[model samples]
Target: MHFTRPRDLVVAGLVALAFVYVAFKFAYGSMPRLPTLAGATLIVLAVIEALLAFSIRARIRQRRVTSALAVVRAVALAKASSMLGALMLGAWLGVLAALLPRVGDLAAATGDVRSALVGTPSAIVLIAAGLWLEYCCRTPEGGDRKHDDHPTG
Candidate 1:
């Protein structure tokens, strides 16, 4: 599968930002308070992906035969995680934009601001870890190139 492109993530993020911001602008009063640690789950997932990347890279560097299925799964997971991170980042940014101005005037906005603060950084870490995991899935130099052994002379 092809590597995940940054442009795609950016587009996804921008779209989510616009949509979320508009939605929140109108409905924020009706919404409940956001949990301060709402993004903690993303951070946990990022840590797991980082650990997996290190293990996979070590196996590749040692010339150990890593399972093809495992590598494919890792790539898929990386791709999905990165996209999720982008969406979440955009979402948090949207919420922040809507709440930051009101933090001083509204009591609820204050708590939501804290949630956005935690979520934004967590999303960023997840994106980095996902990219790292994808990079680790690559084969080392000269490791799996096809042989040009066909007779043409």
Candidate 2:
């Protein structure tokens, strides 16, 4: 899979922000409050992916791929991470945009905005982690590929 394009993410976030801001303007009272743990959970995921990326890249760079299965697994993780990061980034931006103007005026908006603010950075971290993972899959310059005579099972 290819690395995510920044422009696409930016466009997605903009569209989501516009949509959510309008919807929240009318539904703020009825909408449920943002969960406080959301940010923490995303942060945890981001950290996990970041560490995983670093470890996997190190192995790849060293030409120490253990098996075909492992590389396949890493590829799958990279694909999933990139997609999730993009989606979460857009969603969080949307909610944050809605809450911006109302932060001090309403208690719900205030709390929700805080969570969104926390989530935004975490989501960005996830994106960075995902992209790093994708980059790790590429063979380094001048690396030998003699062992890859056959695709790993």
**Each model's C-alpha lDDT?**
0.89, 0.74
- TM per prediction: 0.90, 0.79
- lDDT per residue for candidate 2 within 28-146, as digits (tens), equals 89988888668667677767877877888788778787885776677678767766777777777888777788878898888898888887888788877777776676677834243
lDDT for model 1 comes to 0.89
Question: How well does candidate 2 score on lDDT at residue 3?
Answer: 43
Q: Write candidate 1's Cα lDDT for 10-73 as tens digits.
A: 9989988888898888898889989999988999999999999999989888978548789889
Error of 2 at 146 (Å): 22
Pick out the ten consecutive residues of candidate 1 with the lowest summed lDDT: 143-152
